[model samples]
Target: MNDQPLDNLDGDRDHATAGSGHDGEDHLRAPAPRVDGYAPLRSYAAIGDGRTVALIAEDGRIDWYPTPDLHSPPAFAAVLDEEDGGQVDLAPVDEYRMRRAYVVGTNVLVTTFVTATGTVRVTDSLNTGVAGRLPWSELGRRVEGVEGEVSMAWRVAPGTMFGERSPWVEHSPHGPVLRAGCVTVAVPTLGEMTTVAQEQDISGVFTTSPGSRHLVGLAATHDEPVHVPVPEDVDAGIDRTIANWRVWSREFHYDGPWGKAVQRSALALKLLIQSATGSVAAAATTSLPESWAGGKNWDYRYSWHRDTAHTVDALFGFGLREETHAAISWTLRTLRNPDMQVFYELDGSEPRPPRELDLPGWRGVGPVVDGNPAARQLQLGVYGDVMGVVRTYVDHGHLLDAETARTLAALADAACDAWRRPDSGMWELPELRHYTTSKLGCWQALRCAAHLAEEGHLPASPDRWAAEAERIRAWVERECWSPELQAYVMYPGSDSLDTSILLHAHSGFDRTERMSTTIDALRRELGHGPHLYRYTGMREEEGAFVACGFWGVAALAQVGRTEEARQWMDELLETANDVGIWTEMIDPGTGEFLGNLPQALSHLALIEAATALGSGLEGR
Candidate 1:
């Protein structure tokens, strides 16, 4: 209900006038600019309906939206390829200035455009049906006239499945329906509107006066018959969607120092949770670029086992038992594969083998990808991630089912055998090495398994787990520690340092002198003004990893540097875009977001960092 400023919410001044125009309103009539046919990642805000997410640019262009699911091939992929990739644009015809906010406490977005002639407000949402998600996906946009009269233009253009399939409009009894591959979309409009269906897009223009309203909706389905939405029903659905989000938000109770940021993070995470299967995707989009220099982009639309414990802890902090239970159950059910692949598809299947797309990437970055390559890699640390989550559930006075207990025991036994092997560490790099953090992860997993067995929640060899855990710790101390750098190396006998080791600070790893000293060393070697690269030597390759910066915050708090952690947390909070959504990385020098957006790890880390600081203060 509160109208937070679109800019300068933190008291910073914006030079651009709200609705200002140069040359007597001529310049203000220009459409929002795009560089090389793309908006800055920071300019996009996400709207979703539990199953899929759409990214709307500040300019009122929906540049990215996948069909039935977040991981499906996108219908509007202008975020990746502007020319061939399609977009849906609805903005004033004349020059205008805009400001937007998430209708306060909801993912529903309201953007107000101020033009020379008049002002209008656009409300955007992915409509949800009553009792949960609808059988099909619906995207609704409502426009209301605020004052005077404004001329507005709109278009609905679905893409070629990232240059894979061609889309065409089929005139049906229900109006114009777009078909691409197995996906079908219905375009519906109201309030004196008639659209022209072209080869690949549908567009129309309308004028709005004071107190007038217009509506546009896209109802779509993959591999199913599409339902054409009624404009009045779509308008009502938008309001209902807003209400649903607000109701969910009310249940999330957090009153910490960064309460607003944490709340926004929770809502962002909510969008990434797939309601159908309870799997939490790592992000909403694929191949958004981790570095403008290109070559590092990877699809993050799949769920990673490594994020299980963090997601559960973050959800638990807000008393969201539904999401917490969903994440735990999904992880347990998916890991039954026994291979424990690093990540899985939302439908609990192995990811499609990664393949290069024919389309150009965001900002001309090439080799756009469709799937993640790390799914097959050996990530030894997953043992800890899985066991740690189950242990947390058990510690909350919940008993694990017999099947889950047996799975945990098997995972613990696997960890004991795998601790000595060199594999991809937490970073999922290509190189296999005796990563110090991977060793620490195994040690943490065994410790959790031991505790679970003692509580009768897991059937396992507690004595063997305890003895092996100590041996792993001793091995890490003897081999992974670097006397030359006075810190834990990335791997045994390597000079590089990894911020991933910071995670163990919360895993009950050593908080004594050596670990504390490594924190300072990491800050000196890898830190960039409260941000951090993933590891040593990454500064030249990519931006600072957003999650690592938050991990540093949690690490500082856990290592007993509360004041320093608070200061770092404050600075890091400002790094997010105006709406508090984060991508995988941040360009430290430019302060622009990079990589797939609304990242689960980054938001989860923020929650963990905030909670750590709060708990640290209470213990004092």
Candidate 2:
């Protein structure tokens, strides 16, 4: 095996040994295990048309995508299932090294493969319409040979709905039309390519010589009265889609270290936003699992009030005022019950009950779930999440309507009543513990309410709210703090450290000394190198929560430990796949990514931590 670095294998290089090694005598042997699953995370870049998104690997494989809509069933689900699940692969047939990147300021992925014959750049994207509507949408692939000839093979397989069963397909001159109940896929092809309909998928082959260019489009839609756009129209659609994303990205105010990662996070947030209702999902895919067959998988596609509020606050920091305002409105409208629920569907519908599916989950994690039962749990922290958004908007010069003010006042009163009760904390654990963080979260709500009233933004009894906030704070100190441990425990009567307390600084419940002490204690107990887990003694169960690690970074920066904070932040960034994407968690021992990936919580924390670090450096 050649020991040369893969990055050195580029277009101008010669005699590069970049691909996985294969033996001539074992020509029928299966491929070797990739350095990473499918391909290195670094080899992939994401592209989206706001409605749907696709991840194109450096090797030109569309390994992960939710077609038709961000929340729809995936057309390429290989990111989770690898072998059994389907993927749309368009890569060189020979040993070729690949380089990939997103077009600047847009969610357009471009991957260039350099081979002994020639170099070919393949651009992949889901087409979008003028008004941000996806009309006759298709996954467009444009291949341009930059140097030498490369033989490329294309395969499109729609996996069983979340690994249920393979769909049926039919071939046509326009392309293959794949049907799976309500869903249909239309692919556009050229005359040179040969299309074959297999048992469950359609496969095609096309070879581009030097200086030749070709286009292929995969369109998916429901059973409705719609005219499928022509191949030329789809090509134009790709151009429009790129322009749309570029225009949207220009709205971002961030210009800092890790600019590309932040932009990708912002774009991902945009893609998860339900345009019609303005509700943003926590992620596009659910049940991708926190650990393989670990029973830790949970659905994240639903909108959690806490998650969306955090999203709005993060977007507000990036000068995305429109999205912030829309998200706030959606949140307020969705939680109209006065007693806010933790999660809701994109259209503000009530969340369905949590029930496990009979089918195997991603990577054989059994019993994949749809709806989240966390919605029904009593998470007192939701009041704080709501108040956080409202107060942030008010502080940022966004005027609050009378209804919003009334809601805040009512919510503050509710928090005052609920703060004394023991409930699930931010982690949504089944056991109802007297979580210090949950109590503090309620305290934050009341404190922020008092501030809003003091600032004349809301009608609230400031004195009463302040008194209640003080009581909650005192209770947390008396019951939740463990003086011997020199840190706040996960809950009263428990010595276990929790990363959730890292938010004490951001929540204004604690200053540098208290937060710093808690940080050091958590590091001692839960830190796997620089990545912090949610709690100690849960090694056999949960993976290291990705957001918790970022929370520690933010906490460190808040306490004037900027150097250590930056170091931790860089370490967290290193955990991201090649494309700078993170899952919900990481394996504490090995640092292998776990959970449904491209998690919004992890990205939201990244934005907040980066903003904190960036602001701190600017002050110096």
Q: Please estimate how well model 1 matches the true structure, expressed as its whole-model Cα lDDT.
A: 0.84
Model 2 stretches with alpha carbons more than 4 Å out: 1-45, 80-84, 163-166, 170-175
Instruction: Tell me the tens digit of each residue's lDDT in model 1 across 1-620.
Output: 21322222332121111111122222233334689989998887898999999999889999999987788788889999998788889999988887776776788887778888998889999999888889899999999998788999999888888888899988888778888888899988979865789977899999988888898889989998788878899988988898888889899998666666777788889999999887888999888888778888899889888776788877877878888888898999887885668899988888889998988899898679999898989888888888888887778777888998898888888889999999988988889998998998899999999999998887765999989999999999899888778788898778999999899889888777787888888999998998999999999989999999999888889989888898888788867776677888999998888999889999899889888888887777
TM-score of each: 0.95, 0.89
TM-score of 1: 0.95
lDDT of 1 at 103: 71
* Number of the predicted model whose lDDT against the real structure is largest: 1
Give a tens-digit lDDT track for model 2, residues 1-620: 11111122122111111222221222222222345355533334566665666766656777777766766666567766666556887888888766554555666666667777887777777777888767655788888767656888888887666656568876666545787656788777643777777867878777877667777778788665435567787767767877887777788887665565666677766767777677888876667666555677788878888888889888887888778888889988875674468888877888878877655454456557766778888998888898888888889987887887887788888888998888988989888888888998899889999999999988766999999999998888888888889999988888898888887787878865777898999988888876777887765577778888888888887788888887777777656654455677887676566776567888888777777777666665
**Residue 376, candidate 2: how far off, in angstroms?**
0.7
Error of 2 at 21 (Å): 22
Count clashing residue pairs per candidate: 4, 8
Give the alpha-carbon lDDT of every model.
0.84, 0.73
Question: Which candidate should be chosen as best, given TM-score against the real structure?
Answer: 1
- RMSD for all candidates, in order, please: 3.8, 5.9
